[model samples]
Target: MSNTAAVRIDDTPAPAFSAAPMKIVVVGHVDHGKSTLVGRILNETGALPEGKVEYLREVCDKRGMPFEWAFVMDALQAERDQGITIDTAQIRFATQFRPYVIIDAPGHKEFLKNMITGAASAEAAVLVIDADEGVQEQSRRHGYLLHLLGLRQIAVAVNKMDLVNYDQTRFEVVKAEIVAYLNSIGVEPTYVIPVAARGGVNISENSAETAWYKGPSVLGALDLFEQARPATDLALRFPVQDVYKFDQRRIIAGRIESGRLKVGDTLVFAPTGKSARVASIESWGVQSLSAVSAGAGQSVGITLDEQIFIERGQVASLAEAAPAVSHTLKARLFWLGRNALKVGSRYKLKLATAEYAVEVIAIERVIDVEDLANHPGAEVGRNAVAEVVFRSRTPIAHDSFLDNPRLGRFVVVEDYDIVGGGVIAEAGGIHQAHKSANITEVAHKVDFETRALANGHRGGVVWLTGLSGAGKSTIAMEVERQLFLKGWQVMVLDGDNVRHGLCSDLGFSPEDRAENIRRVGEVAHLFAQAGMLVITAFISPYRADRDRVRTIHPDVFHEIHVAAELDECEKRDPKGLYKKARAGQIPEFTGISAPYEAPEAPELALVTTGKPADESVAELVRYLEANFSLTARNQTESWGF
Candidate 1:
């Protein structure tokens, strides 16, 4: 029992102090006395309040049934009649060394789902086996699950030794067999004790019936299990659970899974890459606390200095130490479905607060739960384990299980039920974070200045911007023809020509238009890098969209705005687009009923309403030659800020 006395309060309140708090799960085969062992622990530790056990015993007697220790956990009438544990039950208790929340996991085949849910939250486990029953199927299966669930701290309790006449040989034989199975799954028990939970022998103290055993008692071995690594020492990971908007402030709330978060700290939400600064740390009842920093499993609410569109399923991490971004991952999963998990089958992967559509790409190997041996298989059978690869339809922020368990685990849902679970072994895909990192660096195999000087002109993008039918395309084509005639390398990327091929799949929505402009900017940047002058003509209406294009080629991006009144452009409807737009045949037609955000600043603006196409082209050429050196030189000069 703990040094602190158990206080009985009318309305139960949390304990003042109880050492380190830990979650321990008890699992084994059905009828293996798992609940009996739990009941014995609660009784021996003095955790049960006065009259509680007597009350239960009286109830059992009134029902004309034998009062078993399992009755303490199997409180439901169905469980008592069925004589099986159907769900996980939790009880709070404490030993001399620490406080515990012991979860009793169900052992029936049909209730393995409940077992998994209970085991996943456990930090340590106890595997129970009946001495007379020896090793059962669930003995091996539950042991394997403890390994798969990443529970390294475990102990084995050989219960009902009194039923075997307290024979040492019988206990050793059962322990050896079970130990071999656990070893196969790469788990080593902290202690293996021979005990009779019903008889209350070898539980809190060594029993004379087991004089041959020299190990610590059950209570002693439990105290030896170490606590999990401290989350405050690891990288910060806070998964947003909800966004609450109270009055003028928006608060992001969640549990801090790892590390500490402080006010004024900059945070980046993963997958979306949105950034924010912590404005205040909020606690429910604390009025004077200015800062909040919590370790693993502590709930926190924070308001940001600047509001950004963020929601649940986005992991908040440090900007420099963000999680991996990918849609493809290799994982090791345990299949618990009644139906086999097959290749090409679609399922829902629930990780943290996110749910994604996933498909099994490959079943690398199926593990024999009984022997822990690998074998080739086309699918993962019911209650089987396998190393599989899955492909998500969209990218998710994650870390390898070995690196961060909080962000690495996921459960698979089939037909609206959780049927499988896994942990990421590796993050790999086309849009990997490593590949994205490489994009930020300037790749200079052939120097940019050298290529420009050899081409006799500085490579740059000539972005011609105006409404349709404003002579922008005509002037762009004429300039391209004139440049080619001057023995200069030039290319024209007309918006219509690009839409026919490069952007054939895009539509005319606002989102699609932004994407179209982004693609054009990328293509133009590549052409300029190759020491060629690229001219682009489009009705790029949004100022933010144009600014995004400018950042792509900041050194040489020139915006030539072609000015024409709406009346003039409508009168010169070259492609009859205005007529169709006015006829209501087009939706989101820029500058016609739809909004058009014109540029606030332009490098050059030309009045093309009454000007000839040749005159506009000449002015463009003069501007380009006066600002850029078109003659070949041995050295190149940097231009623009």
Candidate 2:
């Protein structure tokens, strides 16, 4: 973190004023007076222009209809005629505490998607309920949604109290039922007030009708609603949305999803492990500045001290608080798709600025929205919630929703439509979770030592990495042939050979390349554990990805960098890749358009630019012989093989 941006949230004092308006949403069951509550707030706060209410009354009289305060929020003619809100309508108003943007969401089952769009962005929520109708289906559904959206601060408005004779017993009965239901789903409302939106009781001020009630007014409760922890004070998490080149300088643009960033702060982009220092803060049509700190939802662009190849879908966070990197995640999903969320089905998951192909590997349990009952199911139906395990096609950078909502929540897109939304519950513990649940894992009866003794050699993998046309494949093949002749169990895993089948669906993007290397590493590890020496040849451009492979097979993995100049590799381009890359026919071609991060310290470094192929093979063989002996006599006796 930069010195200017570093500030502990606990040490900061609360501000008396806010530059940004508070965003809150009003939601509940249909015909529960949600729109009326919003309209009453607007009318009392003078948010509506003068004569607007009279104009609506005139229109209602001409049509021979009774005037309704809900008409103020139901702007669409269809909504007014049908007496239902079909979409979320945003109404801006000011309270005594601060300005607020109130979002009125639809309650119809057919329009749950619209409700999600509104609630997902709101910081707090106000759930409306009809005192006479009590708790309805939409009431329970919307309450669960508030929890899923990570909105902890909530207030309840029991409207239509006038219809129930403004009875204190009626209000308490409805409040108790709702409170119990909400508590079952882990939501506690800050305040539950009795109000008749049409009669204006307890909305702006206390009503004589509810003398038994002793809570703050609706407006007062809005002021009591605690503001969320400022993003400037949390850990820095800026997801890169785009990289722009304006004349000579490059600008990285994104909203500071959390925490603050200043000029000269060292930032690391995850899922790629690329780091850069902020050179200057950019603001359009404004005076230039050396440093800038943007809170949540504030978009800003900054130039880096060094131009690095980074694009959308990468999170830029402080190096000290780097995000989690994982290929699988456990999430609680709210399914709204037309089709059921079936296990093993694939969907595109979009979170913040990152997107990946994700699959539902396991459906843990489904919870009924109406009753909050957990039921076992293989698929989650529309308008249902479930806990599921999702495996991404590649690694993703994320945090738990409890830790950071901006980077934790994601939406599932099927056929280009957002069909589902979810919040990450856990990251990087798929295998560990499986083990903790008493699930038995199938194991191989033949141990590694016994297999190695039978093969007369130790199991291992020699990973060869370098730029394209660097003689990696040739050296690997030669080494494999020599080892086979020496009566050792040896095999060669070429990148192109495996791509023909195992990785046919993958491409050359940074994410795809990382997945490709991961798959290859897994295969090589399996071979090594089976008591066979595996040799892998690949460009493996990113050092972080190569490092991940080493972590996968710590004991058996050996990284050998086949050193060769870029010019030499280009000249020796056997597959015409360099020619294609120079002609702009291929993008992200390593050593040309894309980057190639060389290993800082490899097990063996062989210069293949001018040296003969035979000499390079001889050097590789010498190192392998010294490290991995063909004879396992000493280990055979120890293991009693």
Candidate 3:
């Protein structure tokens, strides 16, 4: 192994001071000596109570079993009998540098759920591997789980060095294997040290048994880890728990999950678009103060300047940097339900203080934890990690996990039981439009109502979505022509035409397709506002993408599904693209390789299979006249053509 200068152990320490305790989770495979290592650390650091170790030795002696270091942490009777930890145990200890909370997580496969629960709150980790056995399957799984939980600071301890006779070559081999795997998953372990936990070699002091090894001991490696960033440094996320009315003041009560709040600060409640200013900070037991400021993790009550209808489940943040308001979001979740998690399954999502009814819209991919390979799967089995997309009927406020972990993580509840948990990878559905601080929106002189009256018709968007060869463009063009001949302003935004100019820079990737649809939707909305019928024909495959467009203007946006079977559309092959896709010339072609999620319920469904294009166009024209033509509704006589 490539060695660094030894971290000398100080025999005497200075007086300890107050500091936040850093949480660290110790994990490994079964029989890898994780608990033993934790026990040794506790004993060597003088963290154990005066008589705790003697008490444990007496209990073991009476039980007719030799005293083992693992017995120090395996406190339960079942754990002692089975020689395995079944539950997570947390113990606090203080070193000269700082106080630490060491969470001993179970290594048994059956207790992985409990391990996850324990590691979720940890900021750093210690992964234990057996020196004799090197790395095992469970070791890799635990390492991946640590990465999944977002624990970046890690230390790998090759325990039981005595079993391998303190072999330097063996330790180097194990270190190389684990280091390569961890690096593949974006984890650079802070240190990889070889130690014998049962013998207390390198637990706190250097031992002559492994004199060739020159690195910090496990405790020293831990003390070197930087503390996690304070929550107050992150964006503001105050979830309102309740509101109390005390005499004349209406006090909003909640805990600040991140950032800081003070008197006179303006707050905006999400999903409601309501704003209020903090009039006064209220405390129950304390005397009235001149100025009071609450930061992350503090619970406080405050009265607002204006009395707006505010309730629980609403998040408060600064107006300039608020959480995303969306009905759709992508998540990387680990499913723990008895039944498989499939698309279309309904569950309640608990995010921070808010609860929303969400349905799984898509299962992007199932990740194989052992090898880190992604495979397309229809459902996620128990303990499987998968990337999923969820949609709610109403908008929910949240942030990406990278932005604010407090507001970004959520749990999936079914029948009042938490079946899964995940982090929000991306927020979508309806994005809050933002402009530059110095820029302003110019108002139009001619409004939609005035333009509609002059044109004798109402303007709207007619979005046609379906398979590639479903004749959406053909029917859209004919409908536009018929409407124009009847003295109404109409235009067609065909997929190919838009790609030639407006969306020319984009490609056919899923993300690119969603962006293409978004740009077209915005343009269509602008046309509708200008009193002109805008017809868009595109193979917008994702349901969430279509829903985003409908959310732009539900009153005027009409979705027409040009229904056609995939086989029939492939046979038609109007543009000869299907042949190219089948021959491997094109990649991610919808209806062949990529997925195409048809609309569950559209405004209209026109079956164009075996039907003439002209007939479909005529039917579309009649539907528009009845729904959008204002003159047609009032006239008693028809105009002669």
lDDT of 1 by residue, 391-422 (tens): 66455778877677888889999889889987
Ranking by lDDT: 3, 2, 1
> Cα deviation of 508 in candidate 3 (Å)?
2.5
TM-score of 1: 0.67
Which 10-residue span in candidate 2 carries the lowest summed lDDT? 1-10
- The per-model lDDT (C-alpha) reads 0.81, 0.84, 0.85
Q: Is candidate 1 or candidate 2 better by lDDT?
A: 2
TM-score of every candidate = 0.67, 0.69, 0.73
Please report the TM-score between candidate 3 and the true structure: 0.73
Give the distance in Å from residue 520's predicted Cα in candidate 1 to where it truly belongs: 14
Model 1 spans > 4 angstroms off:
1-18, 242-251, 274-276, 282-295, 301-309, 371-373, 426-641
Clashes per candidate (backbone, < 3 Å):
0, 1, 0
Best by lDDT, which number?
A: 3
TM-score: which is higher, 1 or 2? 2
Ranking by TM-score: 3, 2, 1
Q: Which stretches in model 2 have alpha-carbon errors above 4 Å?
A: 1-19, 246-250, 283-296, 427-641
Pairs that collide in candidate 2 are 231-259
